[model samples]
Target: MTWSSALKKTARDGLTIERTRLEPLLALRGAAGVAIVVGLLLAFGTPKLAVSSAFGAFAAGVATFQRTWRPRVTLAVVVAVGLGASTFLGYLAAPHHAVFVALLAVWTLLAGMAWAVGPVSGLVATQTIAVMLVTVTLPTSVVGAAHHAALIVFGGLVQALLVVLVPIRRWGRQRDALADALAAEADYARRLRHDPTARFDPQPLMDARDAAELTRRQARYRPGQLAGPRGVAERLRPVLASLADPVLGAPAEGPERDRVRDLLGAAATVLDAVARAIRRGEPVRLPPEAMAVLEVPESGPLLSGPARRSALRLIALLGDVVEASDEPVRTTGPATEQERRDLLRPSVPRLVPVALRAVRREARWSSPIARHAVRVSAVSCAGYLLAAGLPLGHGYWAPMTSVMVMRPDFARTYERGVARFAGTLVGVGVGGVVTAFLHPGVYVSAALAVLCIGLLYLLMRTGYSVTSACIGAYVVFLLGIAGEGWSQTVQARLALTLLGGLLAMAAYAVFPAWETPRLRDRLAGWLRANGEYALAVLAVYARPAERKARRVREALLDSRAARREWEDASARARKEPVRHRGLSRSAERAAEAALATMGRVTMLMEAHLPDRQAAASPGAEEFASALRAALPDAIAAIRERARPDWSGPRRALAEWQRREGDTGVAVRGAELLTDALDELSEGLAAPRRGRAGRGAGRG
Candidate 1:
């Protein structure tokens, strides 16, 4: 694409906004909470106290809203503690310049590294650092600072209380995610109807699946998600993915193609309704006509190809899910409201174990997250030192910007830097005008600050640039009460933001941790995980069905994680500064083919199991052994970057298929296992291409 086209595309994408149905309501609630707290404080107290109270309100707005009540309350408490502690320390250190600088550096580094913990912890850390920066600049005694911080904490609690009191569609996010995944699948299937060879982008589907799973996990830490439509959604994800590929079954054209297209539309419609029902907390009511499409049989005289077979399976699966969605939410025991709350209630005993595991996970120096922590700490300290030595009035901007932009991956680091700069510029301009012309009284200024905070919450997920712009305006209005005018601070912000971006780029250049170098290992991991999943699935034929299903579930989860890691690594590799950094075109194709084979194997595993007596087949055990051996060999070959012969595994699978005489569970599993092995071998065998393959390689 040309520069102009690219610019246009960026603008279009940036302007495209996204929000949950309840987001606007949440934003309003947050704004109201801040307004109420600040307004009440301003009525009888000094402007400083009122402003400090807004800090709590702003924290609540930024972190506590939009989450379930349990997490919201927990976040509210954390924000309160973080703001109060930072304020107290900032007060004590404010008299000594060197101590203050060190304090800022330490806080920034710790905040930057908090991303190693999780997304929420990182957000709170960043917010805490911002509070410290502003707090230290204020003129207050230690006691006064504590009082102000306490007020801020109170503000966050008030906001949290509001969220709990006024409930909206609690499962809106999860429902929307499942609906989007289903809709994306339907769209992919529709495209296949017109162009049978169309390559599907599984990212959307994959992302939606990940989001659904994340929500489920979060529900374990919070109440209110007890009735979320998780069961049907989880089962429906793979079914949708299976329908995306055309080569899976018989070729449909003409009337068959029309029938497939209709089915796709109907499926999308049913899922859309399911989404609405979930959001509304009601049972799905599919129309009579929609129900008719699901009745189509897998084996009929009119349809005979593999495509027909796959289509029939998809139809049946959709019907089952539709029925499942109609059932009441399942509970483990007597699941009362109190029981649900108890399950998510905080316990030190439970948390200590989880925290220990998290610590162990982050302890590995060679882990990607560890490398990210080190890089972020280094860059943030460097940015601080550079700004300190210069004449910049608010040197905190340098470290703050660096910490915000330096993500674990390359693409985010570059993208966020540009967006942050652009957004800051827009925000500084708007804030400058507001501060200079309006010269508003305390009430108006307070209201303006509240409005900006609300906008910040609403625009956060849209893009970094838009969010930063809103944040810039918010900071200007916020700092105005702290004695800094927008006119004076705007220039420093713009310049420091630019400098911070450059410093982050330089830091990565010097102490690099590029993803391309790690792609091979990630691919190897995926190979082994998929191999284990395949083995576990095949074992179902020999072992008890109940026991093997649990193993299959565990293996599938591991494989999915590995697959996502590999895809993420490949994406980052594409943007690495090094030439020919990513996999070659042929290698990428091989990886994709392997993924397809894995999907097939997963479907086979999830399919209805045959009797364990099927293990009596003479060739079953021999085939299983060969299949098991192929994965380890593939892993070793990928690690050594060498090609391995697949002849033995191929022969074993072919022999098993011939002996079985039909496509039973064992035969299907063996066939997919062979295909996956072949693909991995092909990927490993493909010669590496240099920079010449850069643009045309895997996306």
Candidate 2:
């Protein structure tokens, strides 16, 4: 064949192959959708069912899809029990209002829990409530309800079978994504220490590190069931463990990536040293030469300006911590100082704000306005259905589906919404066409049920929106089996669904609740909490006895969480106005440093503990109490100064640090503390004339 003809053939062949590969995915998604729709209809629409089996199917599918064993099992059991109890109660009451009350109770309880606990819980709750509501509302005899329940159970079984059998590979994909994220974080952190020019924009590196951490967690939760080279969680365990290392400034070296690797490795050593010091409980001394080695400029040829600055700051901060600990080591030994304070002080100042921001950005869906908008849309959809005189089932399902898919992120919400609308439209149209051809019978319904399952499986593979659309179509088709005709009813249902989507969209966009304002306070509070917790841990560690280590460890963990929360909060605050930013930015960095220092102190504390439990020193105990008492006030001062207009808080913090002699121990502990306080004062006092102008200019 000529070259042109060959090229064309090759292109066509590639396209065909692509389509062929996609066929199974499409089929699976469609089947999953069908299964969910059929289950819902049988459980909620039919007279025989008193509880929703569809929801059970949905919960099971989510579990199978996510590959999380505990949550899936928990959700399934909870939903089953909830639905069964509601059904039994409704049956016992027998009166018209009794079923209504039971349904309301179930819906409220489930919806509330779902709102609080996330999708898995929500799925279970929604199903239980839906089934209860349907059973109570339908004018069905007890035997009929039992039969419906059987059908619902059958539908759930079908859903489970389809989900378990389908080879969608969702968990595998998620795991891969998580692994990629962790690798990126490792790369970024390594670069921060090795690359000088990289300092110009530390945000990217920081962001990558944060993403990596999140992805690591995600991987742990959703590692694919398939056997692999190493489980995602297993691969990530080393990375998470390394995060606690105090000496994170050094990197590791590889063949081509020798510089960063070496730096990370060095950092890891420092962390090891710090951990050792904290465990010892007094002070662990790093050789002067080691301190010098740790002082290498973070900004090198490979780094950017912002990244270099950030790295430099971090290294300098670590140096200060190491230097301060020197005197403490010579004096009482590691456990003489409290463990929590050592871990918390350096990190709480910087990390807390960043973590808070991350959480806010991720969980901003908790806005009241967003909730209201969804409710309004649901109400609007229901109103339209009522006006159009469509069946109660059709109206309720249309709006319920719409609200479930609504999100604060416009793009995501829109995508899912459109897919759902399309799926519903298609499902309704197909159901009408099928009803026209086949007489309503158990055999026909069962066949349709199977078809729905297959479609649901396909939809699940595609996307949530598409899945909703397929499910909608399947639900309408099932209605046909119940003697509803496709004629005008299909058109009416479509119109009502469209209305629901519109209302949901309108609610999402108009007067939406913004999380911007709360960012600052969240960061500040988190930092304060971390600082306090850290001090508490340190106090326990300072007892001069080994028994306090467990308490110190627990307190340190709590402080770590608080620090993370602070960091995330701060990061989010940066996205808003200056006043709303609070102390998040600087606080996050400081917190991280403090935590590293604390880790070192912890190592020292552990090492100093007597082999045979020794009596606690009164001096050490008094010092611990004093430090604990001072930490809250000092942290509060810093936080107060974090305000746009306040410099006084910073001054006060500087004074306190100086008076307490907080500098670990390159000098006298008292002298180091005095120096730190002075430095803080100087730093706080430095004119921000140009900086304020720039910030104001931006405003």
Candidate 3:
């Protein structure tokens, strides 16, 4: 794609508004916290104090809305405390221009590096830099700075306290995640009734697992229902796959197929019912007919051998799900203790070492995250200086815009830059009109800010542009309370905001953390991870043991993580200006399909993994070792543009089939798996620049 087309596409993307659900109660609750902080100070102390401290409450509220696994109360406290510290420190440095800029560079650097931890942490940390620049402008002595910082802390604590007191959706995130996972399985089962080769994304299960992770305090109060359903749903994946796969579970035609469909339909019904019950925190309500279908036929067996066993296992698992739901609503009982051990999230105070290790991994120059750190740190100082020299009334607006809009990627930074300028144009105008028309005093301005905050909360998920608009209006009203002109400072604000956004855009254009160049690297990482996962599954068949089962589970998770990384990199690379970097567009599509097939085959094998007492499958040990031996060579070939060494695995599979023809279901899967790997190698060896539909559909 050309630069103009990419620019137009990104611009169009930036303007697109999405439909989103609104949490009116949650939004009101958050806004009320901000309003309370602003109100109490305005009523008693002073406008400046109220406005300065309001940043803490406002920021804390914003942090709660991020897609984080951490407790909302924890987010509020940590984010607020960071803001307070940044504000106090920023105040001290404000007296010296060089020192303040230096501090900002360091802060931005750290904030950028925080992305190594997670998006939530990075976003929350970045906000502190913006707040630091804005709040430090409040003129104060050292002691006064301390006082302002304390009030900010107080304001943040107030929001956290509200999160605890109201508890609108206590354990809501966990319930939603678990329900989503169950629903996904239900959907997968329904899909299998039609297309047995149907694929399932494990993301929902991953989300449920993440939501299950709790600090010790959190684990104590966690509901019992969240626990058993997730594990049961997890086990059901393989069983569903096993039942659907022709090689392992059911035949393609006749009475067996009909029974398979009927059983699947029944299971879907049961899963959907359980999902609905969990989502609403209501009693489990099973469909009578569906339960009847689950009962084995009295006359004769519909499915023989493996299919029967799979059906029985699935029935037992569903029964476990129902039983888990029957536990008392609020329990700190044995389930709680077991879940605590199963899903322990480290306490915040204990995260220092973890943070250090994560940051250390991303510290190398080769890391895109590290490059982003350098880019943002340098851009922060440059934007601040340029905006300061332009005589803007609120110079920090320029740098803050840059900081907020700039991400580590090309698409987001450009998209958000455009959205920021456009939103600011409309937002400042609306805020200006309100202030000019009403001639409102500090109290009225405070009310307007609170209204904007409420809108911000309710519509934050709608789009980036909407969020930018709300924030712009909020800053306008907030500054109005701090004694900015009642007239719309539209011209000044827009000019500075545009300048900041442009700097952000230019910075990325100059030195980007492009996913395009890293596409091959991502694919190679995924290939290695997927190979390990497949090998682990093969090992379980070779030597079926409890320990191997654990190994298989761990390997599956690692592959899932790797797959996500590859998927994310490809998604980002699609929007990038550099379309063909390491892989041509067509090659990428084929390679992606090949990778998906590899993952799916292993997942199928994983589903029917044998019991500890079962005999080892034919050639499992030899084939697994061959795949393991070939994996490193394949990874290197992907990177070095050489022929992949699949000979070992091929020989193993051929030898197995020769010595023991058609006996091993896993051998059939391994054959298909090797076929996909060969396709992946061909994709890398030559870029398929054929007709649009041709190269894309090969896998």
Number of the top lDDT candidate: 3
Model 2: per-residue lDDT, tens digit, 653-699? Answer: 34545554433211122222223333433343233334542222110
Tens-place lDDT per residue, model 3, 1-699, is: 556876887888887789977889989999999999999999888988898889899999999988877889999999889988998998888888898999999999999999998898899889899888886467857987788888888889999999999988878878889999999999999999898889788899899889888788776677866757888898998898788777778898878988899999999999999998888888888979999999889774489766777888888988888888756567454444543565788888987788889999999998888988899899889988887888657788888998998888888888998888888888888888887788888877899999999999999988888988998889889888878884536667898999999999999989877777777788889999999899889988888754366677888889889988888888887788765445666677778888888988898778777778888765888998888888998898877756577889999999888877855667778888889898887776565334343333211
- Candidate 2 lDDT trough over 10 residues, lowest sum: 224-233
What's the lDDT of the predicted structure labeled candidate 1?
A: 0.66
Q: Which stretches of candidate 2 lie over 4 Å from their true place?
A: 1-59, 66-74, 83-106, 132-139, 157-393, 406-419, 422-463, 480-483, 487-489, 502-514, 532-699
| Model 1 vs. true fold: TM | 0.83
> How many clashes show up per model?
4, 161, 1
- Return the lDDT, model 2, position 375: 49
How far off is residue 631 in model 2, in Å?
5.2
lDDT of each: 0.66, 0.43, 0.84
- The root-mean-square deviation over C-alpha atoms between each candidate and the true structure, in angstroms, is 5.0, 14.7, 2.5
- Pairs of residues at least 3 apart in sequence or in different chains that clash in candidate 1: 249-306, 249-307, 250-306, 250-307
- Report the poorest 10 consecutive residues by lDDT, candidate 3: 690-699
Return the candidate ranking by TM-score, descending: 3, 1, 2
Query: Which model is ahead, 2 or 3, in terms of lDDT?
Result: 3
Q: Would you estimate the TM-scores of all the predictions? A: 0.83, 0.52, 0.96
Candidate with top TM-score is 3
Better of 1 and 2 by TM-score: 1
